[model samples]
Target: MWNLARVAWNLRQSRRLSFAIPPSISATQIDPSFFKRGLPFTTCKGFSTLETQESGGLIPSELLTKKTVLRPDRDIGQYADLVTRVTNFHGEDKGFMVLAGDVFDVPIRKDIIHRVVRWQLAKRQQGTHSTKTISEVSGTGRKPYRQKGTGRARHGTLRGPQFRHGAIMHGPKPRSHAIKLQKKVRRLGLKIALSARTAEGKLIVFEDLALPSHKTKNIVNYVTQMENTKKVLLVDGGPIDDKLKLATRNLHYVNVLPSIGLNVYSILLHDVLVMTQDAVNRIVERMHTPINR
Candidate 1:
């Protein structure tokens, strides 16, 4: 009798222990590397260790570290100044200028640049394209012939799909093609473009873009001094001066814009970016401003 009771008690204890553990961890073997990476470890109810916990597959190699580890701006002490020569309109070196590393040293990303350029182009489109439909077409509504009497194919209105000069079917209409992109993404794209120019050694800083006169000939002389650059973009801190704008108006290869008007598309269009000292300060301040959600 004593032996039989002892056996029954052992069986009940085993069942209780089995029911205590949930199915998720009952047979799961934890990945050893999970703890090495400093990831949080949890085994509470409703919490899962991994997607393939049942089979105990090793953690993906990508999950070993943070994704932003490769970016150059990861360290606070690494924000080195980008020193470049500041020249006057006559192409004479005036002094040296220090540019913010955060803005001009960003890593280049082609996908983001492409996306922002596309977004800017799409937003600026006129969206005026249109086509007339069957009801709107100018034509007689009467059928061409009876439905079954003629041996030729029966016809409806002259503006039908099969007839010449007919209305277009399911054609494109006037609409917006602008896609929604995050403000952070737009800002980042601009930074990347600037960085790319810097990386290519094409960034030029000017002490001042103030032209002595609005004569196109004088501007041409100044441009020729800069190694005969083909495309030039001149940027000022605030509203462009009347003299400068008028002087460059005739030069199709030269464009002038205020710092506020700067954009990624414009930056990439030109071979060189010329900016005043004041413009660089304004740009750096603008980039550092906090963005609100």
Candidate 2:
């Protein structure tokens, strides 16, 4: 009877202690949203409350339509579409694409371009030609004959302009022969050149040319693959990309020039013309400037 009473007392104490103990649970098993009363944000236009972007942010449509894709109509006599919408890599407005054909081939006077090119060449010849004067020639300073004393004709110093190895008499000398053409003429000439190229189907409009690190060989190879020609001049529409510049510098026949650096001469020098769409836009903007011929 004594042992039974002690056992009952111990069992009762154990039951009381078990009831006071807390339930066992894992921290990972707990629901993270248990602390929230309800959804914190309201719904937006077609997007969830949590997915709403900041106010005044650019729409996805604007971001996608920023760059204007130009589809050149080769069948339409090399005409290209002018796209005036573009965004930079940072999604900022970078301007639009103007078709090369429209800018370069706008009915420009051929004579103006020819005159400008001729004048440019002539200007380069200035100070190049030099003729020796009588005083500068190396020869005898003393008179060869007396002045009209004898029956023979009077003879002067050996270094006279009349004699061989003598100073030239009113001959061609170094002089400035700058040809003056009007500003309108110079502008027209550029337009004519552009027009001629477009008419001849020499102009090319390429998609974006994303360059890698500065590697000329790689660039040259890519260009060669793109256009199966050995002689090519690449015009970058934007700033001079160092990687593209350095890659083509060492190549003998390949010329890579920035769009701003391009002119009629360089464009005509190459057999093939490859311009990025961006470069085409830059060229058109440059034509709008009034140039003095």
Candidate 3:
């Protein structure tokens, strides 16, 4: 009877322990905020509190201002100084002056430019072909002279290795001549190139490049004063200036292009680049964006 009583007491203790959940571990289960409303996590904005927790925090939005007015009274010389320092080119050290109010501020990617030019040059081939062996050539059904003594050299088929116009052996086949550069590195290279160009007085900026009519001579004269050279690339921010377009149309070395059409090839090909202040501002805005973060 005493043994039965003890077993019943132990059974009741085990039941009580099993029914009670520990307080310390309870907090780790369902979050208490799940029951709440109107919080940032519970709000119906497509994002859930659970997601926020998973991602480690709220993702900050990129801040952009539409009304970023550019400083017209810019020191082009100072701007060129910055570019020279960044690109590590000797243009600034050489005492090259950058004229303000021109489209001379161009972004460069030196590494990318170097790689691209090198790739282009490496693609050139010597155009040499190989010679084919006797076994691979056609018309070798029978031996000309039984491998042994034939007063004349034991000649095989006409299409043999010794004959002209035979198939080539161990020749170069079509393959990719491209060198792979990382995306980040390529972008940096372009920036460096632009910086170098800016330091070199290659980027030109203008208030406006268009005219009322197509006066090629007027455009040439204007560019000659600004660039002091016939070779110039006139880059505009918006629509083409009709007057500037007409003026440079006949000039062989002058090319008037839109800002959106700018490329590494076009930027590097010209002796000088002329741009409007607005274009420079746009470039600065683009470069200073919070992308580096």
TM-score for each prediction?
0.70, 0.57, 0.45
Q: Which candidate tops TM-score?
A: 1
Better of 1 and 2 by lDDT: 1
What lDDT would candidate 3 get against the real structure? 0.53
RMSD of each: 14.3, 31.4, 20.7
For candidate 2, lDDT tens digit of each residue in 16-89? 75554324533344445533534333333443232114322322232222333333444332335434344321
User: Clash pairs of candidate 1?
Assistant: none
Please give the CA lDDT of all the candidate structures.
0.80, 0.62, 0.53
Clashing pairs in 2: 113-189, 216-247, 237-279
User: What tens-digit string does per-residue lDDT give for candidate 1 at 128-194?
Assistant: 7999889878989998889996798878789986788999999778998788889989999988888
Off-target runs (Cα >4 Å) in candidate 2 are 1-102, 108-112, 147-153, 199-201, 206-210, 226-230, 237-239, 290-293
lDDT of 3 at 195: 57
Candidate 3 lDDT tens digits, 1-293: 99999999999987775454343433345454544533333323442333333323222111111233233354332344332211111112222233322223434445567875565455554445444465666665665667677667776556654667665666565565566555545444445545556666565445555465675666655655653564777777777766766677778898977766565566677777766655555654554555552
Winning model by lDDT: 1
Rank by TM-score, highest first. Answer: 1, 2, 3
How many clashing pairs per prediction, in order?
0, 3, 33
